[model samples]
Target: MITKWEVLSLIWASGVAYTAPRILNRWSLITTCDPIELCQGCRDERRYVMQEGMTYEVMGAAGGPLQVLVEAFAWYLKPFLPALRRAAGRPPLPTCSKGSCLAHTSTRRRA
Candidate 1:
């Protein structure tokens, strides 16, 4: 016989099991960037991180994992996104430049 407590515990565990990895996968986007100063690379990473959250929130367990996987895979090809867009007949986004701006410094860094 299944007691009420056991049923509740199963539900709670299931929720945690589903959410825990999604949360960690989303957090993987955090890279080198000071809390106050976000480099262009930081901005892109953060944007993708937020997209992960939104994707999971909207898609739920059904589609979220696959969509997030696609997104994560896309991050590996960041250098090619500009060319991909250009080939698609879209104007390049301004942040596609080779060097990332760190804070307000004259030195532009990162790929």
Candidate 2:
């Protein structure tokens, strides 16, 4: 048998336990950034680190160990995302139609 006060206390404790780490992590990131003196590389690195950290925190909070592992694996592949996007954005290979190649047709028109 559980009392209402016991349930409330458990809820409060869980909330604090979850929230304190997030707050501290955010504070650490904020304090490390020196807006005026930071270089572009430093800023980019910091941003990436912060994003990865936040991703882990959110994912860990939302699910069990397997979900956290999956999220981390996905996050590890994030750097390849831009390259994948660029490759996806490219036009399809030229196809021949009516004795004229599509690539050749476009080049001839541009000349």
Report the alpha-carbon TM-score of model 2 versus the true structure: 0.32
TM-score of 1: 0.38
lDDT of 1 by residue, 1-111 (tens): 999999977776666566556544434424334533565555675677666667667666756566545544434356798889999999766442324444323223211
Q: Compute the lDDT of residue 74 as modeled in candidate 1.
A: 39
lDDT of 2 by residue, 1-111 (tens): 999999977776666556555444433543365633444443454465566666567656554343334434444345686667678996433222313333323335546
Clashing pairs in 2: none
Show where candidate 2 strays beyond 4 Å: 35-111
Which candidate should be chosen as best, given lDDT against the real structure? 1
Model 1 spans > 4 angstroms off: 1-35, 59-64, 72-80, 89-111
**Each model's Cα RMSD:** 12.4, 20.8
What's the C-alpha lDDT at position 37 in model 1? 58
